[model samples]
Target: MAATVTPENPRTSPTISRSVTHTVNGSHKFVIQGYSLAKGMGVGKHIASDLFAVGGYHWAIYFYPDGKNPEDNSTYVSVFIALANDGSDVRALFELTLVDQSGHGKHKVHSHFDRSLESGPYTLKYKGSMWGYKRFFRRSLLESSDFLKNDCLKINCTVGVVVSAIENLQLHSINVTESDIGSHFGALLDNMEGSDVTFNVAGEKFPAHKLVLAARSPEFRSKFFDGLDVEQQEIIVTDLDTKVFKALLHFIYRDTLTEEVDEVSSTTSSDFLISETLTAKLLAAADKYGLERLRMMCESRLCKDICVNSVSIILTLADSCHATELKSVCLKFAAENLAAVMMSEGFESMKENCPRLQSEILMTIAGCEVDSCSAGEKSQSVWAQLSDGGDDAE
Candidate 1:
């Protein structure tokens, strides 16, 4: 028989071991641990990083250095732990820690649980960083290494932790750190950097079209281009002075386009406005290239500085772009202020303006007169009916 028990030392790591016990009648019994895993701590590294495997449970144990609740730090930071299976229908365990730049572990808030671990065939859901654990524990654990990546999820593990989770748990596969994400980002940056990238983009050779397009734009030429064809060289020089073209070329080559506002145009306007335009253009380019942050910035500017003149433009633009929330707000505002809008000096010029509202005072007078007229009509109808009945009696 085998039995597991906990010790008084809360800090000392707990282990559950089993050994076969033989009885006098050739019967056998197993002893089990009575201790419960601390709340939020789960048994088994039931998740795989890559390759779906059968009969695996995805499991994650989050760690926090300062003991902050996972919900509080959901925005800027997260701690996630994926558990791999270690066979034998037993709980899996791993050492966890939080470290600073100096590589010293933060021990004060570190916590662990002593609980029975087991893995079985199950499905797990992977969601946001923190919510991953809450939704599909097993799936979240397996997929998290890929899902968390550079945005927020933070943690690292030795290869053993990964291998065990994959091999023993029968999990689909193991995820790499930033697990699957950093490499893609690095690849994109690699494409941006050209030969300057130490790593390749998406594990493939850089495409030339992006470089050429970046070279052609006024804002990006300084940052993205280096060597140009004779035709491009001549065209750039003709449209832009050699000095400006040279600056553009420098930006293209370095991929570092930094410029100040130039003291409100005291300096070259090209250096100021051109660079800002380039920044906006590059953001657009990034969005086109599927850069998440660039797209976010483009979208974030919509609700800012909303005004009468701009609101109409924004409304139309948002509608064309299918921005439902923005369109709803604009429509509501238009409905509420439509009356005042029609009274403005330029209201007559707008095709949508209502001219009938100008006669509101006359309409009130007509309404009163109509009530008097309607009263006379009702009396005539009644007299006609009464006269018909009297004639019949006669």
Candidate 2:
């Protein structure tokens, strides 16, 4: 059984014609029942009404008479569609879905359908239907007959079906504005949230592991985090935690935080000292993954808070791994404060243990000159010599 569209004016007959016109995205725009679904319309609740807008068309109708009763083997789905039409064209679109039944409720029956596309418009034709579908669809036409005063067709389908079909449909056109970036970002971000291997950082879910893996190579980062959540979506812009993570995550994403400072505050203390080893690991992992921002952070703590004492192990590890930036800072401190370093036995031992650092320090010490001559004595000596010369002349 096929559903049909009802005309507002009884004097005219119902007709649904579609035209595939070029839109912004280089694809066809399907004008179905005077309303458009862009291209690639999917079977879902959103387009239910539009699907039924064609004259003499019904939706979700299924007929299966296995030599049995009509009601037992026939079904129809309820759907409704409304179009904002202004005399000659449709301005907006909306749809409502009702139900899905495949005649035999005892055995779960699934119905598969397709949309037929042509040069101008598209047609959605269902393969199966029963008498119940015919009656249900016919009632929708009657209900929509007087909806609008414009003498156009009104669609009535049931509400609440999956809208998976129209999601990929795009228009044919050139999108050069930020709207293109924003829309694509929104869709990609939405898909990121849908993945399973992500984490809830603060409140937003992101691919925590993938972010760690993406460090070192930005190409790898882009590829690894390609389908993952973006900083803008999950990370709040104003919240301190989100802001901090945003800056850090971008570094992780792009591998470009070479000279950037990690904004640390009292809040950072909570995570590093009390919470999970995440902060520490992130720092080390950042260093390992070549995240300059994270490495700088570790370096800052290692330099400023010598009282932490345990940071030596980190410095040693970083130096052992040939963290050039970190090693330079450590070498500078040791060379400038050689006296204090020698007295502290720990730093002295560290210096002795590192041959490269020891060699650097020896070079710096050898080049430094210690002048013992006093300025006053040299002046007095010159005066005495002049006075002796005057006495000899007299």
Candidate 3:
């Protein structure tokens, strides 16, 4: 056997080949309103979901209300996923879910994720190629189920395209997460390992780094300019409330509102969710420090709190703080509910101290097309008071 061996040609370079297939996945929800009305739309007629893309190909969900095949009568409804573009030989996995509206989390699902296919992923040979059931659900059973709520039905679809790339001896891939520099800075504030300055605010003190404070606020930067004498300088703040100053420091370091500053949203809470007095004070501090973002945040939070009870007080704050957007919202809200607002204690307080605001309210209710100052009226003109004394003089 050794004597009968033939010589073979030798190759110069080493090479490797690999073909990897994976799916690019996406999900879409399609809601059918007036479900009962759609029930009689004849056989083979389908309602399609809005086109959504996955793996650079267009797809849609088609729902047959009165069954796809006439032989099955109207007993069942059909669901299918069809290739929406003019592509050929596409492979995919499909899943259909009927959401339960009863809040019991009992969703009806037919999924490819849990099943094993012997021949692999389903292939769509042409543009109209589809994969689904002719009898997706029994019509009678589905109509009476918790899947239908308020004459509406919701269907969720998941599609996975099996045409991804292959990698051979590729370099390592790294997943970069979202930036969390604020939290680290926040931790630095908490530990106070090398705190250089202290703020004495209303008999309470907060120790913080001078550089961080200077970077966050121009007012703090101006204070630190020209170099200081003391290594750990203690600055006295007389005007701010203790809690307000604390919250302001937290905002300066953390770039977020404290737990005391709740979003005063009607959707989140029926009553004013934010500590109104505390946040108003915070806004004043933000304005004084040239923190525009923090000032706007405070304005936005307070705007959601506008109602008859708080509108007058909020409007006064808005005018004083120069929160134009919040002021506009408060004025509109107050004008729309003038009667209720006038009956509130906050409104009476506004009438006594903020007569200018009362005049602005009247202008808003009168549908004044221009600003009072620009409408040929002096900026400092005293507004007329409608009183019984005028009639007595007559």
Candidate 4:
């Protein structure tokens, strides 16, 4: 049997809500220049205007001078609204009106609303299909009325598009514990079973899989498979300690550093701190192997652990590795604690090793001092002030 324990203060689940709605209207005016002549010459003859877009679909207005059906030929004029694009099953409302040009505002309207008042808008299933009255108006009556003016007839079509609202629900549940696959890989690394390649780092040998190393590091890939001889098995790694190399391999196999670093600190000593020294070395190694994510992780840890004792060394390391964000953090920290930092040996090391970074530090300190001084206060050079305070008691 397994034991289960509940927390004293259980967290509540979070809720999320969403809603959206949109409507678009497009109007097209179709003009017939010689209305009397066109009506006299046509039965089963129609004219189509240029295609237009509305609500992400193409449409056109079709005008038949004579009635579309032979039953109503020479008696009524027909008009229709058509879908022109390759769209399927589009639901929309349509209105076709013959404008009364005499300014009486007595326009004739034929709409989907008049036919289906209880139901909803009409659905268009395919292209080249239409919806309207075949016998829209009597040809003689329309010609005599204000609908035809100066031998021209104007027809207006309005389409009102309704975009349906979309709603989504997201449940925010409590944190549930789960198994970590990285721990299993870490266990495999610890066991060192079925190893194919050996790396000798500062006189300590580390056995690792060639495939795993190549997958993790491009430098390892080229050295192991592209450039080096196939029979070459042993690689000697210099300028890096056994601990740092072990941590790098641990990251390659396990994809994490938390457990590996913790285990290393425990084995070495309870008081052994995971110092900026180790992190800086790891960051350098990560950059060399093109492990950008690992480099960023190391930079994040180093940024949080910045202090008076470690800021200078970390700043130099950041400059060397081209870690821009970490470099900015270090510069700010150093400028704030300039007096104490300048007295440290790490600062002296930076001054000797990276003069360009030293110049950047001076500029940052000057900028900070300039920002602090108000317009009423007398301006003093930051370097002059720092020089005068050298070796002075805090």
Model 4 Cα lDDT, one tens digit per residue, 232-311? 77888886898889889878887877544421221232211433356767889988999988898888877766666667
- Pairs in steric clash, model 4: none
Computed on alpha carbons, the lDDT of every model, listed in order, comes to: 0.33, 0.37, 0.80, 0.76
lDDT of 1 at 84: 35
Q: List ranges where model 1 is wrong by over 4 Å.
A: 1-296, 340-394
**Top model by lDDT, which number?**
3
Candidate 2 lDDT, 214-324, residue by residue in tens: 544464467557745544223322323543444455555344342434333421323223112233334555554456656666555444433222233334545655455
Off by over 4 Å in 2: 1-283, 306-317, 348-355, 367-394
Cα deviation at 153, candidate 1, in Å, is: 43
What is the model-wide C-alpha lDDT for candidate 2?
0.37
Candidate 1 residue-wise lDDT, 1-394, digit = tens: 7445557534544444344322111111111111112222333212222211222433344442222334443222233444333333322232233222223443212222221134322222232122122222222342243323232322332111111222233325576654544354335544554433221233333223344445335333443454444223212122333333223333333333335202212123232132233333443344333334433343344444233333344344444444555545544544444444334333343223433222321223233332353644544454365447668894
* Candidate achieving the largest TM-score: 3
CA displacement after TM-score superposition, residue 99 of candidate 1 (Å): 43
- TM-scores of the models, in the given order? 0.23, 0.27, 0.50, 0.45
Backbone clashes in each candidate structure, one number apiece?
A: 30, 35, 0, 0
| Candidates ranked, most accurate by lDDT first | 3, 4, 2, 1
Instruction: Please provide the root mean square deviation of candidate 4 (C-alpha atoms, Å).
Output: 29.9
